[model samples]
Target: MKMDLGDQGLAGNAAAGGRPLAIEARGLIKRFDHFTAVDGVDLAVPEGAIYGILGPNGAGKTTTLRMLLGIIDPDAGLRRILGAERPHDVAHAIGYLPEERGLYPAMKAYEAIAFVGALRGLPLAEGRKRGKALLEEHGLGYAIDRQIRQLSKGMAQQVQILGTLVHEPRLVIFDEPFSGLDALNQGKLEKMIRGLAEKGTTVIFSTHVIAHAERLCDEVAIIAGGRVPFAGPVDLARDRIRPQVRLETRAEDGAWRTALPADARREGRFWNFTLPESGIEPLLRALIEGEAGILSLSIERAGLHDAFVAIAGEAAARALEEGETEERA
Candidate 1:
């Protein structure tokens, strides 16, 4: 649980780190009167990266996005959007999908998109054509002329997504973009999000849910109670995660106990190990080449779930200790 502040560059260090950041926030702090919503958070999203922010509800993900969009000013921090200092200056270049979705129920799908496009200064005629084209491309062409309220939940969500992209922004910020869709719709949306990234749009989004982020993001930063617990590439996070391996041997033998790694345990006939750095490979070779007939060996990499568990567990421990200190004082 020890924090490793490695040599990875911060989000806003443009002078030294010349790699253009798709999105950057440094020392971001948000306070509503006396209650701090977002603490000092440092987040860096690389260009064309589907960066994920994960935490439970009320974890300040929405608040942080609000600050970044200039909906709410941070108590203090630095933020840049596609290299601009102010959100309004680059607002047209940023497509936002807020966690709480709102669209005009009375407006037709194409009408809504055209309205948004016009607001961003795109021509009404072009917006109309592209909006209808987007509908057709996403298989929502049938609903293009229908009022928003006439469409199902999934259909409405698709319209919102289409509208967000109508301006062809450089960056797309989607807060819980997968929240309300069915499995099929979710798959479609996932493909759409990845497609946007493939087309070179930078995406940074927050989710209480982990699986979508795991499937979509190249890198992730986990925040809890408004502070980051871990931030790095997915592999790096996996490495930092508590290393646990699942191995099943043939003939259902419990002989694994004799040659097992130090921290290994037995469940039925399977041997599980929480590997330390030194003894993984040698231990695996010993298990495999020796009399322990290996049947099915599956090494379970610590996923975002494990990462979040590790993160939240540490945060709880820290909060407990700090509360105890206050009580003692």
Candidate 2:
């Protein structure tokens, strides 16, 4: 019988409930020779959440993930995956896509996918059956029998991802999954990640790109300089920074100038400034009382990038921006 790769039933049957924490780590520390890579990190990933570990390159994201998967031992700290203190025993229940991509050039796409499932103790026949269905579902049905070397980069990546999901692991971890894809492929990946979460799978991904986390994560951890400076709901991170206000006025008299705070900067007819703690009401009242005819006013909520700069400092933020710029170019 052909399996339904689009079946949401996988989540219904395997979804974790009541157990609030799917992954937990306390005071995790890792060092390589003399260099301390991960220092005193704590993480609490809620069950079934789309969690993100966000940071620039060399931020210890890979190290932390390696520790969590038991691929490497932490110098200090404790971690639990799926309620098991030791990840090795329950390793089969987890699916991981590493930062590095590797596939045998001569291997057929379907066989390569099935091979990954076999590593997780799945029957080869069953793995191949599901692999074909998953490929078809992800718009790669024609590539099922194609050699890995013969496929395009995006098609190869899609096959690899299908391999990661063929076994239907409860927890899926992706490290820089969007690194090489174009905008359209990135959008497709984002949709796929959301679909996994809707089916009750706990998805955790690490990326330097803030936009992906902003659009997809329920909670995120901001790692900088080998330490996690911030971790919580996405809203809480944004809440730490004040909203920006942009106001354009028809009147540019002294009264209009006086109404704005000292920090306000005028560019053309628009006054751009950060909202003060006293809030927008006071500013609006002052502007109206001074007869500054407000042509337009807009309040822009702080986004993940703003929050990152506020919390992780400008250097880290700059790295992220530069990385994005390079990708675009």
Candidate 3:
């Protein structure tokens, strides 16, 4: 039976871009004995978007995902998946790839994909057919008949990813999806995610790697210390701080230096600072009149890494760095 989720107004009716949400959670809490693994976490994943859950290891990302998938019920709060209050009721429309990946080592690649599809109610024959086609499209056709144990580590991961899609789920959730893949395979996975969103599939993946989220996600939730410090469009997060300015000049000291912001620092012959609130035009005029030989001037917006530090604090950011170091190891 579907439990009443009450009013959904808290998470809002739609995403900042006006797209309908595929997943909505409000004040979600989970506990393990006396340990509170997740504390009042909330998420709003827009439909047909590439959403990212970003954090360090053990920041409750996995626990929150489990709750969203209905693998475990939250101790408090509520969620809706694909318009259903009960996530399992719409299980047919969801695909999940957990952080702990496993497959029958003895099973053939194609058969493994088909088996996964069968678990989601797809007919075996059709699943096999689709699985073979998917492998071919992904350049794994030669491995279709190869046993899972016979394939390289990267190939095995590719097969598992294909299995997740063989059932053609409307919403796909991945927990630390890039955990074990090398750079090449990671790039391949990023491309695959973009393809899914192009086909109107909603894809949510959790990762500690900020670059992947920075490149691929439409919106993201930054989870740290078991709570979300930031959520919504990726640009909005970066926009919390001003764009950085880099000015290269032939003049080392001139009247133009006075026009530079108070925070401006001299780095050899260059001036680096945050763009001032009054904007750059006045600064440009000052530079020209003062004969400060401008070699080059550029403005760069803050990237997600910088935004994450600014929003989630240095401690959480350090945890993120340590998690990344461990992943690299």
Best-fitting candidate, scored by lDDT: 3
Query: In model 3, which runs have C-alpha deviations exceeding 4 angstroms?
Result: 1-13
Tens digit of per-residue lDDT, candidate 2, span 1-329: 12122332113212233447888877788888999999988888888899999998888999999999999988877777887878988888899998898888898999999998888888999999999888888888899899999998877888888888889999999999998888988999999999999999999999989999999999999998899999989999999988889999888785657757778998887889988889899888888888888899999989999999999999999888887777667
TM-score of each: 0.85, 0.89, 0.94
Residues 1-329, model 1: lDDT tens digits? 12223443243434224656777777788888789999988877888888998776677889988988888888777777777767888888888888888888999999888877777677989999999999998888888899999988878887888888898988988887877777788899889889989999888888766777789888888877888877767777777676777777775555545667677787887778776567467766776766677777666678866666666676644553453344335
TM-score of structure candidate 1: 0.85
lDDT over C-alpha atoms for residue 286 of model 1:
74
Ranking by lDDT: 3, 2, 1
Q: For candidate 3, lDDT tens digit of each residue in 256-296? A: 78999999998887789999999999999999999999999
Can you tell me which runs of candidate 1 are displaced by over 4 Å? 1-19, 248-258, 284-290, 314-329
- TM-score of structure candidate 3: 0.94
CA error at residue 12 for candidate 2, angstroms: 25
Q: Kindly state the number of residue pairs that clash in model 1.
A: 0
